[model samples]
Target chain A: MNFLAIIGRVVLALLAEIGRLSLFIWQSVSHIFRPPFFWRLVAQQMMRIGYFSLPVVALTAFFTGGALALQIYYGGNEFNSESIVATIVALGITRELGPVLGGLMVAGRVSAAIAAELGTMRVTEQIDALTTLSTNPYKYLVVPRVVAAVLTLPLLVFVADIIGIMGGFVVGTTTLDFNAGVYIKNTVDFLKFDDVMSGLIKAGVFGFIIAIMGCFHGFHSKGGAQGVGRATTNAVVSASILILAANYVMTSLLFAN
Target chain B: MSDAKIELRNVHKRFGSKVVLDGINLTVPKGQSLVVIGGSGTGKSVMIKCVLGIIRPDRGEIFVDGKNVLKMDSGQREAVLRKFGMLFQGAALFDSLAVWENVAFGLIQGRRMKRKAAKDIAIEKLAKVGLGPEVGELYPAELSGGMQKRVGLARAIAADPEIIFFDEPTTGLDPITADVINELIVDRVKDLGATTLSITHDMSSVRKIADRVAMIYKGKIIWEGPRDRIDDSGNDYVDQFIHGRAEGPIGMDVLKP
Candidate 1:
């Protein structure tokens, strides 16, 4: 009975927190349409979230694709299905690994940075300082980040997909005893715009999740140094988890048709 | 022009079970500087945040230039915010942007000025804060703590606001640097003829920058008077706080821990 009561209390508290978060998200989204749009800040965020983030995402995708290609070929040859290696590698990377892994990687890097930076600002009363100056912290800080992520993650995913496919090709041709021409042809023939588009769409959603979690945790952080640290960890963990969950749901939806 | 620039009436703010601001009532006439002074966690920052609309009060109203801030629409709030400038405690400069870009953040992002023009004004503002044109090219991380504070001050004054808020403007600086920052603050406020509100535990800052001093304790302004009368405010909490006594009423409450 005591365990059940504790579980009930925890669930209720979580629900309440979720409800508040949803409200905050709604307000943030609504602020986009309202006046005093900070376009410059949005552009700056795009540079930070999208541009600066590229090297990491690209590097991760390249290695992921190369490893997938080699591993799939070895696994497939054992079953005498070596001819399908390129098709399988491309499909798997585009459909699953590209979006999901990319999202998680970006979450680990970007979300933690955002949370730590903003959390420190919160502890130092910088957000409050913005308000006193009559600047909307939401408009100045949150909106730019959210909008930038929503816009840029898809681009990042698109780039990541190309780099990942290239990685797979390098592994296939150089290490897996496959002809470069055949591997390229098979990859091109097997993948569809829909497959890539699905991944890109997932990227967009994952980006939003990463940014929202980062901003939310940072904005609500309390205490001092320890609070900022907790917020950073929470941001990364929640963003990664949400990205994975959302990827599953999105993939199911996209392929269900 | 001669009116109560900012007014907090019977404002109350509570963080869970702990009431942070309890029935705060105060008025600052236009172009005046009012500094709230108390020990750490005494609700000085909370009171200023409530007035700035950064933290909503559980009860009561805040008025800026006789306009009810809490009731303003998003557009209207942004408009009101345009009249305010703030120098945060830790100089929350955007790390990704150059020093000039950080100073011109509000002007460009909030106002959408062309980049060249923004850069020019940012340079000028940097100069006002004792930073040279060359300093504009450096990132915020490259600056020392004192330099960062100067950059923050430059950003606060960049928009040429009618009112300004300084949150612990001199808390982390060396005594000489703190004094320099205080003088810059006084000079800038005078130049703009801007009404000002600041929260600080630094008695030197209060003495140097404040026209009036209010001592807060247990989330309320226990005493307020002209700066000259602070030494004889006749309130035990105010006396203890101003004198930095560890054996007084304020210390006794904290001593329980």
Candidate 2:
């Protein structure tokens, strides 16, 4: 009976959390469509979320691409199909690694920052202060971040796709003894526009998830310094998990045909 | 009856099994400073948040200028909130913004005033709080605790709100700084002739700024009277709290044998 009661409590708590998150998403998205938009804030968030994140995202993609090319060359050599390395590297980077890796990296950097900042604001009563000042915090704080992330992630992923393929190309030509012209030809020939488009679409969704999770956890933080710290941790972990889960779902849907 | 600028009629709030505010009834008259005093976790902050629409009470009504604020829609609520301002316990200034921008946030963002015009008013308000124009350019992180409180006070009165709420305006300050803040509160309230509701456990602040004093115990306002009458209220809880005594009717829930 005690075990059953414990299970019941866990189930109920989980359901309540889901309900709260759904309501937060609804409120934030609805506020995004309302009037009195803060364009200046949105622009500022773009710089913070997108431009500042370029270095980390690029580095992650570049290294992943280089490693992927080497792995493909080694595996294909066993089948006497080592020429397939350039083709597979380009397709893999464009279709999956670019968006997924970029999302995960940004999830770590941007999500943690957003959560810590908003959590501090929540614990300190700045959010309540915004209310008394005739401003909706959703409009003033959450909307700019959500909008920036949704718009900026796809652009970041696009850059990552380019940088990732370049890294692969460099490894293939220099380390794998592949001719530069042939490697470029093989990559461009095998890669489809649909593959790139699908990844960009996934990037946009990943961006939305990252920002929503950060804002949700941060907005609900309680206690004080410890609570803010907990929120920051929760935001990054939840966003990274959601990004991976979302990437899988999107991949199956986009590629099932 | 019509003279009451703010009124809470039997407001009730609870978090899960714990009741934070239980049937709290209070009123603040026009052009007066009514301070609600209570120890930590007594729902003093919750009660003020309820009035500001930051927290929804489980039962009862809150009124500002005879309009039931709890029943107003989002647009109506925003319009109603335009008449009010607040100063939070830790000052709650937006760290992302400069000092002047924090003061002018409502003016520029909520009222849609141009930046140049709003900045002029922000500087004026900062001056009223004894901060120079140069201080306005610095961020909240750059200011001392006392200066942040003054900036918060300046922001509260920036829009010339008809009503103001101060949530523990002197919790972390030194005694001398606290007294300075109390003086500023008194001066600002006098200059604006605004009806003010402040929640604090600081007895000195009550003596310096409160026209009327209310004491909350166990989520209810147990005693209320003019400031001059607080010493002779004849309530045990009031006596214990005002005197900062650990013994008497208000017992600490620390360690039990």
Candidate 3:
């Protein structure tokens, strides 16, 4: 009976958390269309969420591409199909690796920062202060971030795709002794515009997930320093998990037909 | 109901099993300062937050200017919120913004005033709080606690709100700084002729600024009277609290052995 009670309690708590998150998301999104839009704030957030994140996203893409090319070279050795590395690298980077890896990296950087900043503000009553000043916290803080992330993530992922393909090309030619002209020709031949678009669509969704999770966790955080720390951890963890889960769901849907 | 500037009728709120506010009933008339005095975790902050619409009471009616705010839609509630300003315990200034910008946030963001006009008003308010224009350019992190409190005060009064809420305006400051804040608060309230509701554990602030005082105990307002009458309220809880005595009906949570 005690074990059953414990299980019941856990289920109830989980349901409550889900409900709270849904409400927070609904409020944040709905406020996006409401009047008194802060164009300046949105522009500022785009810089923070997109531009500042360039280097980390770039490095991650470049390294992942190099590693992927090496793995393909080793794996295809037995089949004498090592020549396929160029096409595979381009297709894989454009369709999956670029957006997923970029989203994850940015989630770690941007999600943690958003959670820490908002959690600190929450604990200190700055959110409440915004309310008292006749400013909707959602409109003033959350909307700009969510909008920026959604807009910026796709752009970041696109850049990551280009950088990732470049990394794979460098490894294929220099390390694997593949012909640079043949590799480039193979990549351009097999990679379709749809593959790139699919990844970008996924990037857009991942961006929303990252920002919303960060904002939700931080907005509801309580206690103080320990609480803010806990929120930051939760934001990064939740955003990363959601990104992967969402990517899988999106892949299934986009490829279903 | 009788045209009080702020009124809470039987407001009830609970967090899990802990009842933070239980039937909290209070009223503050226009152009008056009503300070609620209570020890930590006695629903003082919760009550004010209820009025500010930061926290929704589980069951009750809240009226600002005799309008049932709890029943209003988001748009209506926001309209009501325009008349309010608040100063938080930690000052709760936007750390990302400069001091003048923090002070001018409501004016520019909430009221949609142009940046140049808002800056002029922000500077004027800062001067009212004894902060020079040079101090306005610095960030909140650069200011001392007292200066931050002063900036917070300036921000609270920047738009000349009809109602103001101050939550622990003097906490975490030296006695002199606290007194200076209290003086500024008094001066600002008079200048605006605003209805002010303040909650603090500081007895000196209560004495200096409160036209009327209410004491909350165990999620209920246990005693209330004019400031001059607090010392002779004839209530033991009030006596214990005002005197800062530990041995009384109010026991600290950890001392329950």
Candidate 4:
């Protein structure tokens, strides 16, 4: 009975969290459609969330793609290994690894940053200051971040996909002793438009999850510096988990026959 | 009382089982400077927050200009909020924005004023707070604590709001700087003909800026009177607080070593 009570408590806490997150999402979305749209803030957030994240995402994609090509070459049958390496690398980077890995990387960098910034504002009473200044905190803070993340993540993933494919090409031709032309041709032949599109779509969802988790935790932060620190940790952990979980659901739905 | 610009009746707020505000009732008459005096954690800030709609009271009605603000819809609440400006305890300046942008945020975002025009007003407000136009270019982080508070004061009065709330406006400042802030508050409130609500433990601030004074103890207003009458209020809590006596009716919750 005691164990059942503990399980019940956990389930109730989970439900409460879900409800709170859903309400926060709804408020943020509704604020986006309302007037007093902060175009400048949104543009600024884009630079912060997307433009600044380029190098890290690009680097991660390049290394992942290179490592994946090597793995495929080493593990596959000797006869078809070269062609299989190119085709699988291309498909993997564009359809799964680019968006998922990029999302996770960004979830670490951007989510923690947004949470820290907003959480500091919360503890310092700046959010309430905004309210008294006749500005909606959701519109001023959350909407811009959410919109920026959703719009920029797909762009980041697109860049990541291109760079990742280039990484595989470099590895295939230089290290694997494959014909560059043949590797490029095999990659192009096997990759479909839907594969890239699905990845971008997943990137957009992952972006939403990341921003929402960061904003939600930050906005609810109490106490002071310690509370803001806790919020930052929670934001990164939650966003990474949600992005991975979302990637799985999206991939199955998008790829299932 | 009928001419009260802001009024709270039976306001109650609780965090779990601990009550922060318990049946708080207070009033600020039109164009009056009313300072609420209390020790830290006595809910003076929470009471003002309830009036500003930053925190919703568990049970009670809050009125602004004869309208029950607690009952207003979001749109109506925003309209009501336009009448308000707040200076937070920590100044709460947006660290990401330049000083001018922080001051002009409401005018540009809430009022949709042109950037160039808003910049001019921001500089003008900064000048009023004894800050130079060159100072406006710097971010909040680059400024000293005193300068940040001045910037906060500039921001509070930027929109020419009809009401102002100062949340421990002189907190964390040296004596001379705190006095300068109090003087600025008095001058600005007079210029705008604004009703003001300020929360502070500083007796010097109370003497300098308040037209009327209210004392809060254990989440309730125990005594209220004109500024000159504060010393002779006859209430034990008021006497103990004003005299800064540790061994009075108010007990500190600290564990004895």
lDDT of 4: 0.92
What tens-digit string does per-residue lDDT give for candidate 2 at A122-215? 9888898888778889998999999999999999999999999899888888888788888888888888999899999999999999899999
**True interface contacts reproduced, per candidate:** 0.55, 0.89, 0.87, 0.89
Positional deviation of residue A40's Cα in model 1 after best superposition, in angstroms: 5.6
Cα-based lDDT for every prediction: 0.85, 0.93, 0.92, 0.92
Rank order by DockQ, top first? 2, 3, 4, 1
Off by over 4 Å in 3: A78-82, B1-3, B253-257
Q: Higher-DockQ candidate among 2 and 4?
A: 2
What is the per-residue lDDT of model 4 for residues A75-124, given as tens digits with 9 covering 90 to 100?
Answer: 88676888899999989999999999999999999999999999999998
Q: What is the lDDT of residue A120 in candidate 4?
A: 90
Clash counts for all predictions: 1, 0, 0, 0
RMSD per candidate (Å) reads 3.5, 1.4, 1.6, 1.5
Ten residues in a row with the worst lDDT in model 3 chain B? B248-257
Question: Each prediction's DockQ?
Answer: 0.45, 0.87, 0.85, 0.84
Fraction of true interface contacts that also occur in model 2: 0.89
DockQ-based class of model 1? acceptable
Residues B1-257 of candidate 3 have per-residue lDDT tens digits of 46588888999999889999999889998888999999888888889888888888899998889899999998899899889888988899999999999999998888889999999999999999999999989999999999999999999999889998999999999999899999999998999999999999999999999999999998998899999999999999999999998898888777466
Which of the predicted structures, 3 or 4, would earn the higher DockQ when compared with the native?
3
Q: For candidate 3, what is the TM-score? A: 0.97
